[model samples]
Target: MKKIKTKEAVGHVLCHDITQIIKGVKKGVAFKKGHIVTEEDIPVLLSIGKENLYIWEKREGMLHENEAAKILYNICKNDYMCPSEIKEGKIELIAEKDGVLKVDIERLCKVNSLGEMMIATRHNNFPVKKGDKLAGTRIIPLVIEQEKMDKAVEVAGDKPLIKIMPFKHKKVGIVTTGSEVFYGRIKDTFGPVIREKLAEYDTEVLGQKILNDNPNEITQAIKDFINEGAELIICTGGMSVDPDDTTPSAIKNTGAKIVSYGAPVLPGAMFLLSYYKNTIPILGLPGCVMYAKRTIFDLVLPRVMADDKITLEDLASLGHGGLCLSCDVCSFPNCGFGK
Candidate 1:
């Protein structure tokens, strides 16, 4: 940094914020630090009682914050996401469509580990809307070393660190298994709960079947739904270890490869995940899902709607933050359940 006359500061980066005060009108920063001085800016500076100014001087191996911010933007941006205009050396990434936000957490951590540059994003695998702020990046100093920015770019790899996976409109099929609900001894509340959850992602329920605890009938229903073009199949209830429970066996009988018969999540420990023909996903939801406001289903539903493949390892890894607090007010997605 160096001090120079305002007249000679053209084309230089401002080293400090210039404030403008007008009673009852405005009193704030007129020009923020890191702003590039222009020929027209000299008169504004003079009017602000600036006969002399402090500005960044051109130096080797150093980049102004604005230039460094662009590097951060390029490292993280991808399709369906765009960066906002630079302001005070900061650039924010906005989602271009309603979809799930996918962030490469490992790559993002590596980039922020390098000093003088940083990137911050929303929780991964959460739903996002168009124009939502997904991430923000900036250079910490008014001037940063080009080598540090290059290192951050290197850590990001060839692909962008952040992406918005546009949600796919899937036709879902429901198979409510149990003797009570199937025989009308109890009201069927599970179907409505599942439909309301699906509505959040704009998915449609193609068809539904109420089947007793007969594995053969359950298997046939699943096959019929698949034949009718249902992209996702959800089997509710009868997933426990009881001998009478046959939902899991029925799903397996459909020739679907069972990924896992149980998950490590609370209020959803009996959750089952499988794939039909290695393509469409089949979920066996526990009874707790009908009563719990947030569960493992809420955690994994966004990825399923986004068409992101969920492997057995993905379900296993969710054990780290899979327990929902079951708060009375139920502030989820913003909670720590799936972070």
Candidate 2:
């Protein structure tokens, strides 16, 4: 860093903040550190009594903080994400649409492991809304070695390390199973809840079928929905191990590959996930989803809606933060549950 007249500092990065004081009005930083002195900022600097300023000295093979931030942003950004303007040596990624956030955890770790830089992000494989903050990138110093950022690029490989898979429109079918609802012994509450949840996304309820616990009838209903062009099938109720619970068997009978019959999540341990024709998803939701404010269904719904395939390993990874606290005020997705 070197001191120079503020008039000659245009285009140079400030090495320290310029403070301004106003009697009974305001007292704050007039110009922040790392701010590039622009012609328009001259009056502001002069008003702040900054006759001379310390600025980062430009050097070959070294990049300014904002430049390094751009490099990090390039390594992390993908479709459906927008980058915040570089500010104070930092940049943030924001979602441009509702979708599921996918993070390349392996590459992310490698980049952060390289000292003096960081890429902090939200948990991977979670839902994000439009304008939601996805990740932030910056280097620790006001200037960084260009070669170090090159290494980060190499570690990230050809593809970006972060992405937002936009939710796709889907035709969904609901199969409500249980003899109680089928025989009018009880009202069909599951269908309403499922419909309400589905309304959150771009989904068309192709149709819904209320069937008894008979595996054959349940199996036939599922097949019929698929035949009618349903892209996703949801079976609510009858997911338990009880002798009368037959939804799991019914789904399997449709020749769909079962990904997992149970998850480690509380209130959702009996959750079942399957793929039909390796494209359409078939879900057997546990009874907990009917009443629980947040469950595994909340975690998995975004992925399914985005057409992001869920693997058994994904389900296994939920055990660490799978228990919902059932807080008096529910702030799901923002909380640690299913993270």
Candidate 3:
């Protein structure tokens, strides 16, 4: 690119956008890239303090910032993600649907580590809504070497750096176990909480049964729900080691594979997780879930809704970020819980 005095550059093309700022009244591009510099435009350029402006000049092995930004966008954009118009050599990625955001951390780090360009994104595996800004990319200078962008793309490889997995519509069944609630001795707050939680993922509780702490009865209820086409089953209460707790036993009797009977997360340590017929997830939630606003359920539910299996190792990893601050006013999902 060639640089010339703003007053003498009447016919040259602008290589970069000259921004005009006026405190709260206005802040915008005074002369956009590729705009021909007419004699009348010289005064406008001087108003923005542009003593010298760059004119278009191509170099082999180099790319303009706008082109570099598009290359970065191409590497990160994927299904359910949309890119905004490139402005000021920057492009922002927005979510096309309400769903969970996934970022490939390793690749993202490698790309950012490459000098002269960057791509910043929202946290991975977090819930996001439509129109939410997921990521932004830009080149540091007016131009960057093409080799740098190629290296960034190579680090990103064929995998998408950002994606939104839409939540699935599944029929869920809830089996509330405990003698007090089964006999109406106490209000079943647990049932309602489980229902409300599932509803967040667009899952409907198709069938729910109130059963006392009887292994056989709990087993029968679970089998009934499966026969009724319940894709996910939840057995709340009776997961502890108390003599009357039989939810775990009942789930085992259903011949489902038990992933883990206990988790490392606080407020949900006694959580029981199992899978029926290798497809349906049956969770035996402890009493803590009824009162805690955020728990292991919040951490694991999104993965389930996205059809991602929660392996034992996955549950074990929750220990690092398991404890919730339990603020009086819960700001779950936005808080550190399950991060």
Best by TM-score: 2
What is each predicted model's overall lDDT from 0 to 1? 0.90, 0.93, 0.87
Worst 10 residues of 2 by lDDT: 42-51
lDDT by residue for model 1 (1-339), tens:
799999998898888999988789998998899889999988988987999988888899999988999999999889988889999899999998998888899999988988888989998878899989999999888998888887887888999998888999999999998999988999999999999999888778987899899999999999999999999999998989999999998999998999898888997999999999999999999999999899889877888998888888888888988888889898887788977
Give the true-structure RMSD of model 1: 1.6
Off by over 4 Å in 2: none
Which structure is stronger by lDDT: 1 or 3? 1
TM-score of each: 0.95, 0.97, 0.87
Shift in Å, residue 145, candidate 2: 1.1
Candidate number with greatest lDDT: 2
Candidate 3 segments exceeding 4 Å error: 5-43, 46-52
Model 3 poorest 10 in a row by lDDT: 28-37
lDDT of 3 by residue, 72-121 (tens): 99999999888898887899999888888888888999999988889999
**Pairs that collide, model 1:** none
Prediction 1 TM-score vs. true: 0.95
Clashing pairs in 3: none
Which of candidates 1 and 2 reaches a greater lDDT? 2
**CA RMSD, predictions in order:** 1.6, 1.2, 3.4
